[model samples]
Target: MAEFSVTLLIDASTSMTVTADTPEDAAELAMDEAGNPSLCHYCSGKMDVGDVYAARVYDGDKEVLDTDWTAQQLAAAEKQVEKLEKRVAELEQAEQDAVKVPRGLLECYLNGGGDWVEAGHKLRALLGGGE
Candidate 1:
């Protein structure tokens, strides 16, 4: 068994906000069937992995509050939504820029042998796994 290191570059920033959602639908669409919804290596966030809902949506969009304030007659709700979309994109890019994952360091541990299993076993032991 080879030695491995785990390093996490978690953001301790106060401006960061995270949210999770669970979609009721899992039915594969035509694009999904054809692999159109591809997993983007660079675009992926920390919340990407275990999400039943779309993580990219949250990463790229701002939260619209439930309020009585209405969209103007000229700009419309669609325009507001569009503005939110743009904000989300900017935020997602900034988030990616702020945190850098050492993919090579990860590859060393993952591609090297038995590291994942060993780590899991150790965690299980800490959580009361018996001999």
Candidate 2:
């Protein structure tokens, strides 16, 4: 395998309980208390998260693939989020529509090789359910 350089970034957050006069003082106090994190029980929400952000492939000191994976991944994630949100909204609307549809109609629709989801939308439209 060719040697590749990869960069990953992690962001960690730890909650600390400290008594201080100002925000700066609190930060300082937190650091001072950080020596023994286990001693603090009141602290909460300790989290560490990271994502692979970049990679580089080199050929004899010449850079070949220098890519910002972070940008690409973020764009992809945004698109997925958009799609998921739309799907969730559709499902929720269908759930509401299901309440309006008669059981017989739903049974017939399903038995006729119609998916419940599409059936919900079409049935709702025919039933004069506004939006």
Candidate 3:
């Protein structure tokens, strides 16, 4: 069966009364054997809303995957962000390098852009790929 998590919040005030199937079943079993149920009238009378409580039943913690797709996607996005930052720095430095040379040379280099070697190098360093 699939695992599931169920959180039940119960109010412990005078207006609310919480009952569980296990206790009710026990009471029924007592009634079947004896003339009266497992609980006495005094037991029911003493019951107060303060006895109410929140119960949680976690059915799927062990069977579920540790990391979901969203977590993987978030990690991928972090990598992409780092890569983009490096690319931006490379382009900025290239711009500074271009300023030192002739406009024509800079324009030519800009127009005929090569591979993303410079940006990739920087990103690789950021990602611990070494120098």
lDDT of 3 at 13: 18
Q: lDDT by residue for model 1 over 12-95, one digit each (tens)?
A: 211223333421122222113333233467746432333222211123464332111232333477788899999999999988
Please, what is the TM-score per model? 0.22, 0.30, 0.29
User: For model 3, how does the per-residue alpha-carbon lDDT over 1-131 read when each residue is reduced to its tens digit?
Assistant: 89997755434312112233553443344333443223357765654333222222222342211133565577799999999999999999999866644544444445546435554554445556765
Give the per-residue lDDT of model 2 (tens digit) for 2-21: 99876554444454355666
The order of the candidates by lDDT, greatest first, is 2, 3, 1
lDDT measured at residue 68 in model 1 versus the true structure, 0 to 100? 17
Best by lDDT: 2
Each candidate: how many clashes? Answer: 1, 0, 0
With candidate 1 superimposed using the best TM-score fit, by how many Å does residue 131's alpha carbon deviate from the native?
50
Runs of candidate 1 with Cα error greater than 4 angstroms are 1-75, 101-131
| Clashes by residue pair, model 2 | none
- How well does candidate 3 score on lDDT at residue 44? 54
User: What lDDT, from 0 to 1, does candidate 2 have?
Assistant: 0.59
lDDT of 2 at 33: 58
- Lowest summed lDDT across 10 adjacent residues in model 1 is found at 22-31
- Candidate-wise lDDT, in order: 0.43, 0.59, 0.47
